[model samples]
Target: MPPRIPVSEAQIDRVVAQFYQRVRAHPALGPVFAGHVADWPVHEEKIGRFWRNALLVQRCYDGNPMQVHRAAGDVKAQHFPVWLSIFDAVLAEELPQHLAQAWSALAHRIGRGLSFGLPQTDDADPVPYLG
Candidate 1:
């Protein structure tokens, strides 16, 4: 049998809600998101499902995150660090030590992959492989 996932749907909902709440308040991330996101509730629900699919291994999320982020135009590679930082903070505040750490690692990995696929400007390096 597959190993049981310890996280719950309610926990995923809470984390998504809280994380976006903080992201909306963030200086760098807030503006970028505001440009693309017209309806906060819908966006949050979609993201919540994404996380549920990611962590719980559920096939609830349907959209392609890479395509969405790439289409945003303003989602720079540098944004991943700030995004991951905010996400890590949210995870730390919302979950127990083990869960937070595990989620943070996963988030970072996903962020790295997304950032790597983005087009870089002249000032930015061609390489997106982040440590």
Candidate 2:
């Protein structure tokens, strides 16, 4: 395997764009995202900035992701693995092994936080991280 390259904004943009493309096409995830996202281009740019901030510590993202996810209401713990799977696949395709693993770890952490922290309407336990 090649040595891991440092992550860049361009790489972040690529990953976000490709990941969303897959998500928007996925059977389970596509509808969930489409229902919540009214504008794809604008949402994509915001997501790119979010990942850039996360991977590069750029402080470009300021939204409360937890609140946003919670507000989605339809988002359930079951959706997290689907989201992570898509994200992991994109990172692996777009980045070096080390960078993909690093980003995957962060994604898992964030996924877990969102899964467990989001308000639940029912008594079902929060979904555990599958990645």
Candidate 3:
């Protein structure tokens, strides 16, 4: 195994920012996310904590992600697989393999652990282009 790269808060912030931007800009998902997010800065902070806790063995997060996604109502179950795929892509270039596997596993776990109403077949995770 490769040495575990120490991920900083800033790096996680950048990843979440990039991911959220792709989600917001996605044609299928853009409108669904509009106005629903309410506070980007706050969400950014929350995601920073989320990623930190997610990568580490800490359990600082008090709430459940399934509930958050359920409330988001913008994303459905099918969207998760693609989201995982896209997220892995981001990690593939930026994060190391172990980190990539960890993130991907988290996404997969989230996908299996949650479900929404009848999913729309057309909705898919947007391809992230961090340009």
Candidate 4:
């Protein structure tokens, strides 16, 4: 196997772009996101900045993601795993193993936090992965 490449801004951009494309096409996620996000290109760039800040310590993102997610009226804790799974697939495909693992770990942490913060619905149970 070849040596693993370090994660970079370019890779982060690629991962975010490709990941959202998959998300937009995903059966469960597509409708949810499409309903909320009016502009794909702008949303994608903001998310890219988010990941770049998270993964590379670039400090480019300033928006409150938790607030944004909370305001997404249809989003629920149940949706997190689907989001994570898609993110995981994207990282696996776009990144070296080491970088993927690192990114995955961070994503899991963020996902769990977001899941925990989501307002509980009477019908929905918190997922074990968030615990």
Name the top TM-score candidate.
1
Candidate 2 vs 4: which has more TM-score: 4
Q: What does the lDDT come to for candidate 1?
A: 0.87
Best by lDDT: 1
**Global fold similarity of model 1 (TM-score):** 0.88
How accurate locally is residue 56 in candidate 2, as Cα lDDT from 0 to 100? 72
lDDT (Cα) of model 2: 0.84
Question: Residue 6 in candidate 3 has what lDDT?
Answer: 57
Write model 1 residue lDDT over 2-85, tens digit each, in one string.
313478889888989998999999998999999999999999999988988888878889999999999888898889999998
Is candidate 2 or 3 superior in lDDT?
2
Q: What TM-score quantifies how close candidate 2 is to the native fold?
A: 0.85
Runs of candidate 2 with Cα error greater than 4 angstroms are 1-5, 119-131
* Candidate 2 steric clashes: 0
Provide the overall lDDT of each model, using Cα atoms, as 2-decimal numbers: 0.87, 0.84, 0.67, 0.85
Better of 3 and 4 by lDDT: 4
Ranking by lDDT: 1, 4, 2, 3
**lDDT computed for candidate 4:** 0.85
TM-score of each: 0.88, 0.85, 0.70, 0.86
Estimate the overall C-alpha local distance difference test score of candidate 3: 0.67
Q: State each model's C-alpha RMSD to the native.
A: 4.8, 6.6, 9.2, 6.2
